[model samples]
Target: MIPTPEIRHVNVTRYITPLREGGSLPAVADADDGFKYVVKFKGAGHGVKMLIAELIGCEIGRVLGFKVPEVVFAHLDEAFGRTEADEEIQDLLKGSQGLNIGLHFLSGAINFDPVVTTIDAQLASEIVWFDAFMTNIDRTFRNTNMLMWHRELWLIDHGASLYFHHSFTNWEKGAQTPFALVKDHVLLPQASELDTANQKLKSLLTPQVLQDIVNLIPQEWLEWEGYEQTTEEIRAIYFQFLTARLAQAEVFTKTAQDARKALI
Candidate 1:
């Protein structure tokens, strides 16, 4: 089993500016650690569920040897919002005056464009496999949430993944669900070795790895209404869902292969 990552906890010292590109309105904030982070507020429209998805998706990507930014738990003080001029931003700070998610900001990074940058076949195939396993629908060609920094590609903004947690009433429906949208993936055409990638990466995500990744999510984030399960119980549900998906990885792997074939 891979070592459990120690998630850093920091306090937000100052709110630098709002990143208005995303619908949730994430902001760049100066943390006490003397680093800048793109903070995802819990009060955002998507709520804490998005934060949970971001954390889980990031951890999974990291375990698969993908380039993902470091994530931290940032404590937002209520007084920090009083100085903000924008009412919307101030409200966001006020509501998220506690534990929020922060992603280490990559300075001087440019948005990845397939036209300008070429991804290697192996890396591309692994990334496509990972996204297919996670049921991530956000990595489409139009809004490729990828960045090129220092001539290397980095994954970012995984709030749209693990979408099954949004509604737990019929959560079982998500298990083993075929990801038909893999065809729209930005890297599908470049993913030439899906079979090899799947074989190699599948072993990395053992049950212990899945449990460890799910355990990284804050308990409060899982305390949604309409769920009868306790926080730990809810976490187990996520493990079960992922384990089921992993067991059926071949189904999604074939889907991605077919998509790549069509693109070629």
Candidate 2:
């Protein structure tokens, strides 16, 4: 079994500023650990599910040897919101006066522009396969949520992946559903070694590794209504969905390959 990642907890020292690029209004905050973090609030319009996705997606990326920013659990006190003058910001902080998600701020990181930067075909294929396996739909040409730091690509803003959890009514059936949209992936044309990537990466995501990743999610974040199962049971459901997807990895791999071929 892979070593479980140690998720450090830090207190919000100060609210630096709001990142306005996205609708959720994530912020750059100074934490007690003397580090700046891009904090994703629990009270955002997207709710806690996004936080769950961010944790799981980033963890999965890390396991696959992708450059993902360090994710930590940030603790916010109600007092932190009292100093914010903006009503919206204050409300968000007040509501998120508990555990939240934070990505370690990478200074001097530039947004990855595909037009300006050329990516290695092997790495591109691995990323494509990874995104396809996760059923991530956010990595498109228009808004690639990636950064280039020290000339290496770093993935960010994975709150939109793992969308199956949003509607768990038929999650089992949905697990095996084809990711037909992989054709739209921005990196599809550059993914020239998907079969090799699939063979190498798929072996790393054993059932134990997936379970270890799911276990990292805080219990409070797992609570959801409209599901008959308890919180732990719901967690188990996630494990099942991921394993089931792994079993059908070839289907998604083929979908991506076919999509890439069509684009040629």
**RMSD in angstroms, all models?**
1.1, 1.1
TM-score per prediction, in order, is 0.97, 0.97
Compared with the true structure, model 2 gives a TM-score of 0.97
Error of 1 at 48 (Å): 0.9
lDDT of 1 by residue, 1-264 (tens): 589877999999999999998999999999999999999999999899899889989999999998899999999876878977899988888999889999999999999999988999999999999999988999988999999988899999999987888777666778677798999999999999999999999999998888888888888888877768898888888898899889878999999999888889
lDDT of 2 at 174: 72
Residues 40-60 of candidate 2: C-alpha lDDT, one tens digit per residue: 999998789899989999999
Whole-model lDDT, candidate 1? 0.91
In terms of lDDT, model 2 sits at 0.90
- Total clashing pairs in model 2: 0
lDDT for position 8 in model 2: 93
**Candidate 1: residue pairs that collide:** none
